[model samples]
Target: MSLGGRGDLTARIYRQIRDAVLDGRLRAGERLPSTREPAGRLGVSRDPAGHAGLREAIARHAGVARSVRAGADDVIVTQGAQQALDLVGRVMVGPGDLVAVEEPGYPPARLLFRSLGARVTGVPVDDEGIDVAAIPDAARLVYVTPSHQFPLGVPMSPARRTALLAWAERRDAVVVEDDYDSEFRFGARSLEPLQSLDRAGRVVYVGSFSKTLLPALRLGFLVAPASLRAALHAAKRLTDWHGDLLTQAALARFMEEGLLARHVRRATRE
Candidate 1:
């Protein structure tokens, strides 16, 4: 049945309960937890990491636009890029692990790593992006806003990108590439993401809809290597179980219809 209003929503829920009872899945005295599960039931089922269609859409979009090497299985939908960082940290970070971030960088990222018991340190950024040489040798993870550097608006130079990837490989560390706000570039050629250049699976590319679409949407995704998949999924399940499936479905349809590209073009022009 079509859900046109509150009445329709109620009727849909009622029908689901009725069907559950009929199937003997729910006993007569059993009570529903009365949470967002109702909404999940109202639409498609949820995946702890993300909806499958949305994951595929993200992979296709990033592969084409950003040259990110990812498949649908590598994409994990997140509450936002912040949660993507959180998941990465949960899986990779440990107490006393050194986490490097750009100086004068994103505060939330620094704070998040610190909260996870990581020894978060800020490495200075020059016109070339983060100074990779200054990053401590013991640092196991480096977070960078390379495409359009946070607050600085400087793109990481090609040499710097190569150097960062090399450093990560040498240290056996991970790099979290926050490619936020690259969609709105006006007069510059886009830089290839670190994830695209990372042959050793050292980079995790994160993107968000908060800047592209709407902040209230709370939509974001991360593209990670195959090795991190199982741990990332487990972290996602432990953190929130899953995101809003209906919104994910809507975004997937939007991307599949090519509306997102058109919208970005129009928005960039304006």
Candidate 2:
């Protein structure tokens, strides 16, 4: 995939290697020069975690807005929320692993887990949210849209949130919290996200800017626990290396200047 950016020397070299691989000119298992030389020349290592500026902005904004506890290093930028889920699946799911999704949940997440060779099961959702008791014991990953239940639009009650986290800890499973569209709330303030409430670091909080910004921008991020950070970073590198740095830089500036919060406030009022 084209990591869209200005054609710097590094970008040109990356493109050459990419083209050669795609054209079958660079066969697998062939040794090539290490990247240390180019990395030294550029004065920056190839970081799969994504743009530093954007990750810092996301950490700062999410800390205040979502009550999420994280640092810039904990954030992994993705093409969108969908890609965040994909990376999580890549790290956590294996063939025949049990994966659970909320009934009538986000279809994309369900399909994603299934595509990763997981045995997907749907747990029932009530007004409070997905019934923690209904989740399978063997599930290795549970995907939930707790802030605003997908298709049902009900915020998970605080009690339910606590129960779900406890369940995850007891089951030794990970929870994927898709916080998509929670920024557009029109009623009471959103309950604490599972990420904020989690003490065991089992929640992978996934968020997207598609509702707040233009969907075509394809910006999103995930706040992963320390335990999964390395695996998630590796998965991201293998998937796309990184995203469009130019867009990430623009978004970072927008957030750092407080324009993003201002836009959200105006959107909420309207």
Whose TM-score is greatest here? 2
**TM-score attained by model 1:** 0.84
Error of 2 at 232 (Å): 0.5
In order, the Cα lDDT scores of the candidates are 0.87, 0.88
Candidate 2: 10-residue stretch with minimal lDDT = 1-10
Off by over 4 Å in 2: 1-45
lDDT of 1 by residue, 2-93 (tens): 22233344446667777889999899789865647876767633468787778888999998888889998899999999999999999999
List ranges where model 1 is wrong by over 4 Å: 1-46
lDDT of 2 by residue, 1-270 (tens): 123344343465577678878998879998664787656766644758887778988999999998999898899999999999999999999999999999988888899989999999999999899998889899999999998999999989988998999999998899999999878887888888899888998999999999998899998999999999999999999999988988887788789789999999998899
TM-score of each: 0.84, 0.85
For model 2, give the RMSD to the true fold.
Answer: 7.1
Clashes of each: 0, 0
